[model samples]
Target: MTDQKSKDPLHGITLEMILTQLVERYGWGEMGRIIRIRCFNNDASIKSSLQFLRRTPWARNKVEALYLWYKRETAG
Candidate 1:
């Protein structure tokens, strides 16, 4: 038997963790500009963003993509 690691960068990461890191790195203002979603643009909160992202697939995809980009950019 062989142990295989998951290739996905987000495999063990939760949406909350991703959102928290992004907020810490970019803040809500930049995040709004980056993704252009109401949740992040208007009265943004971690709880609200999490709810919105959980319900919206496209939005969630964008967030996940952004997280991956952030990770790659900061890898060094």
Candidate 2:
């Protein structure tokens, strides 16, 4: 068997890592504006945000997309 996840950029990355980086770069207030989830809108913690994101696919997709964009923006 082969690892199929090697082709994915986010394969090895954890949701907590993604949220941490976004929060570090943009902060909770900005993340709320960008994502508008209750987790990001209220007392946003990695545990809370991860729970919400795991249950909500749409919101999770938005977060992943934003993380990718953030990575590109900061790459330069």
Model 1, runs deviating above 4 Å:
none
TM-score of 2: 0.88
RMSD of 1: 0.7
Q: How does residue 32 of candidate 1 score in lDDT?
A: 98
Candidate 1 global CA lDDT score: 0.97
Using lDDT as the measure, which candidate wins? 1
Q: Estimate each model's TM-score.
A: 0.96, 0.88
Compose the digit string of candidate 2's lDDT tens values, residues 1-76.
Answer: 9856587879889988998999999999999998888889888888999998999999999999999999988888
Ten-residue segment with the worst summed lDDT in candidate 1?
67-76
Clashing pairs in 2: none
